[model samples]
Target chain A: MTEFDREQHDHFLRLFMGLEESLRVFVRSLLFTHDEEREVMQEVAVVLWRKFDASMDGEAFCRWAFGVARMEALAFRRDRARDRHTFGDEVFELLSQTVLEHSDSLEAERHALDTCLQKLPEDQRQLVQTAYAPGVKIDHLAAQLGRTAMALYKTLHRIRLTLMDCTRRVLATEELT
Target chain B: MNTKDPRFEIIRRSRDGNASSEELARLEAGLREDTDFREAYVRYMNLDVALSAVAKAAPLPLPTAPPQRPRWITWRPLTAAAAGIVFGMLCTSVVFGFVAQRTAVKKMPLSVFDAGLEDAKQILNDGLPSQEGQWGIDHAKVVSADGKVTPLTGLHMLRLEPIPREKRVKNHTSRAYQVLDLRSLSASAMTDNAEAEVSASFCAANSGTSSRYLIRAIALDEAPAKATKNFWSKVESDGVVSESQRFDTAPGSAGWQTFSMTLRLPPGSKTLVLIFGAVPPEDGPQPASVHYLDEVQVSLLSSETPLP
Candidate 1:
């Protein structure tokens, strides 16, 4: 490989891969569906890498990366202007800005989820994992388990709330100690 | 964490695709006005992303050992694997292959638009009291599944509510026109005996009067934009075929039923416009009556050569 190309790949891969999860969560928070998140994340990665510089440090790079993510996600939302579920441009701007402000706390909550997930009952944790498995459709899973789709959805929602409660407790306890 | 909170319902339904437009509006408002709601929203979404990442990294939950939250799924593993000089050349190709595949990523599913309405907004639905987004509608208000109903598959379904009496015209059935491009198929699939099979799931309130689930399929040699002009004018003579199922939904009736119709493509047809319609009985529409549409699909069938 050419020295110029090798340097670009090395520099881009290190920073980009390291921040991949943050960028994903950032973009996903701004969009409605997982597919939309995947789409916007790709666009964000391309824009970040294409304009990436070796001189930029972690903080500057993160700011720039998040800015790109915000724009791309908004653009994606605008394309679906007909969709009723999507946030309007004003609401989207407000939410994205809020997410940026709370990025650090959100990241902490994200870490807490790892521990909270383990605290769940074995069956519930198994179900949550199965639900989020790659390309796992709830309907198909429901049929396999002899449960109706609505029943399955209700169960999943309850599990998520439990996880949320667990994470909040974990974070609060951490604050105390 | 309060399931009883309206905010929880709104947020959960919005994520699950069950929230109506009104509920979504409330969610948007809460996200803007309430700081607590905003924190909850951020936390929920953060948890969602983290769970998905963990689930993706370890598809099977480890009952015995805790699965680590994967920071970057493949990077560390690949670097460790690359430490061996014996497989230097092989490792380089594999790493480049993975990077190239990731860097060159395109957007989602192969279809140009999401047919399932689960992802992209290619399919136009529910413009207002008398319109279906870009497509004009009949005596129907394309509405979202509300407290009384839910979507057949995804979080959203087209609920064909009655149009206002003053705005309603006589003999106008409640339906939406779906214009599908015939150019999407292979040349071999567009034969003299080629047929376009149209199918969609329909549902009604169980305590409703009898209603006719209707479908009218037509093939045109003109473009989609031009086909609509001559659409209602054409009948079931050559390229068009219509089929329907009339039923009286009882207390324990089937919720959503799939209906289909097939239209033989007139040779050299360029487009297909399907009318997914609903016909009420001679009696006026009932308060509990509903005509819902979801999971619409169009596929090719042939007498000689199979659909490629």
Candidate 2:
């Protein structure tokens, strides 16, 4: 490699090396397996190099890298190959029973969720708080905010999806570690 | 029809706490008839339960672990095609990420002006009385800054003043015309009544037909037949008209025809609309002389009189 290219590669490596372990675990949950997760991380590194190879500032690189990691995981799972295990009645029942019996797993899931919430923007954090506040019904909050119930429902739907992904990643990495 | 199709209704009833035990059993029986529906409903219910539980419980600390790397990173490339495939996938994901980020940044719904109004005016609708028949202001004329007149058409309304011809003489000017359309205007459901009152003013006639124009007002009322027939009957009984004569300086005529008319509305009617039209006489090039209108007011009248 040329000197400039080598410098760029080293810059990308340093950038990838600095991301928090928690962020990595968060990204890995979106992937089906460890190998796929690793593949996504490498792609993230390559993309960071391509984007910021000229300057490679740490802040820009971290954001770019994690953002790329998330996309790669989503794209990887979007492939038809990952749909082999269909979610059916039995699986759903097992999942519910699992949640009921394994309180620690539920707690672990909650912990992962809290961590993910911490990672969100300050505005999003407040939104989650307001949504889940005790005795504050969704319909009442929606009316107070001049929003329809359907709109609030859709917002909660997106938040739930994000939490599921974050929790899955957190638990997966906790197992690995 | 499949029992699964009624799932939403049953769920809504359950959510509302209005479903009886028998109703719940019926819903459950319906759910069991379709495996896919039952599985989906179970998953949805469980997710809701878990999320609700988490929302209720105290926050917990999440695990911290290093992210895994891709398996292909350490693997040797087999061929140029394989390398190219890997490279392409990486590039595509990065582009997709960038696009998603940009889209999120915009945070606005992309909309175009296809609802059909000049200048993209929002269609005014609030349960006001709808137009009974074909109603709109179509013809218009542009007053150039150079004191010249130009014909306008296909444009319904303008909420802006007409830029005078002399002012529109050059690059420093804009071609302006007074336009109006009353098709989409309506009254709010909660409101009692709505009406529009407009007045047109014309500059005195010059050597030619510069300021001479015609003003026409059209109103469309759409309500139930009972309300409309009552409104029409009241208009026929209590309608007032006062006509007078006026002299025109340019034509050196003794008297010209002038008329003023007002129609009272009936009771129980919820919506009333008024549309005004101003047409000008035909000048040198185009025949219609454009007239300038002054004050136009739309007001909701009191609902008190009951129609017989």
Candidate 3:
């Protein structure tokens, strides 16, 4: 590749690395299965890389990247419809709109989320981490922990709700200050 | 926010892919109708993704090598032999089972509607005509009658005009509908033992106001006496239409798109109604909206177990 090409490649990589976590969150909000979400994110990354030159500056990167991610998620959902439990088009449309509208606020909340997660009690934090571990089945984890899968899921759900509430409160206070 | 909100449980189960079909349906309805529920659902999913990222960032400890086994310990030859035999049998069965499944399932396209507007027997208008002209199908205009613009296959396409707010006021609402009845074709092809998949290609150009385009699949016990007025009345009442899916069109939305939905026919249903039109905006006069529809197709798949 030419020097200019190499520089463009490096620029694309930097932007991708910076937005990778946010993009994953955006993709995950649209999909249920973890594997499918990751697959869609990978596809989005490739498409973003190819179209990086055409992307405008300012908040355009987030808008364009999330737009691409939305289409990828929709296509993934359509392909997996017959085999898996997937949300309908209307739900996805609403969810995508909500995410895009709140992207800035959500970015702020992400910082607050880190603090909220750190404040989680040791046992709850461990449960949250183990539940989200790569390739780790909730049923298997439940078996290892000597609890029913539903019970464990309920615990995780409660922990997530608590963290979300805490993050919202933190962000709200920050906005006030 | 109530911690005990059952909606949260539904959201959790949905995220985990553990939600039942009924729960999923309820969640979908809530997402469409309830704003607070939708916000909570998004926040919960965002939290799950954030937690997953954190978990992945935290490095896992490297595995330590196990201590060497004692020299005295050894595998039992008989147990090993039995295990090998069982594994071989299991692998053979799995391979054969997979091949059998692949060959047994069949996806057959029962019927395809590729003809022009002549095939459409009934055209019903739910709203009054605008001042420019009557709101109905225009067979003269052609927007890719050959289905090149859209993924539909047909020789002729129907251009449907949207009723303005004044026309909609006659119908008691700002929404207007132009319905095409395909009961003769669909009823003949439908069977109680199979599910029908209906799909259509649509393109819309909205004026200043936004409009919602919908393709509703309705099944009736019998054809209505007055197709236009009574049909809409029945649609207004519950239990008249089987399934309906909507697509929203903004001012700048000007491309052909395709949408498909599977309908489980209700018992004692004889006639099938396919309604296509735009829903008008309330409180003001609606901008002129035009929709081009073509290549409507319905295929049936038999729900029978294949012979081995």
For all candidates, the clash counts are 1, 24, 0
Q: What lDDT tens digits, residue by residue, belong to model 3 across residues B33-81?
A: 8988887777777777666655543313311342232211121111000
lDDT of each: 0.58, 0.36, 0.55
Higher-scoring candidate on lDDT, 1 or 2: 1
How close is each model in CA RMSD to the real structure?
18.4, 30.1, 24.0
Is candidate 2 or 3 superior in lDDT?
3
Candidate 3 wrong stretches, greater than 4 Å: A14-19, A58-61, B1-4, B60-308
TM-score for every candidate vs. truth? 0.48, 0.23, 0.47
Ranking by TM-score: 1, 3, 2
Query: Stretches of candidate 1 above 4 Å error?
Result: B1-4, B61-308
Error of 2 at B129 (Å): 72
Best prediction by lDDT:
1
Query: Against the true structure, candidate 2 has what lDDT?
Result: 0.36
At residue B227, give the lDDT of candidate 2.
Answer: 31
lDDT of 3 at B61: 34
Please compute DockQ, using alpha carbons, for every candidate against the native two-chain complex: 0.21, 0.03, 0.17
* Poorest lDDT segment (10 consecutive residues) of candidate 3 chain A: A1-10
lDDT of 2 by residue, A36-144 (tens): 5444654554455447655757766655555666665556556633543223344323333333344355445544654666666756555655665434567798898
Task: lDDT for model 3, please.
Answer: 0.55
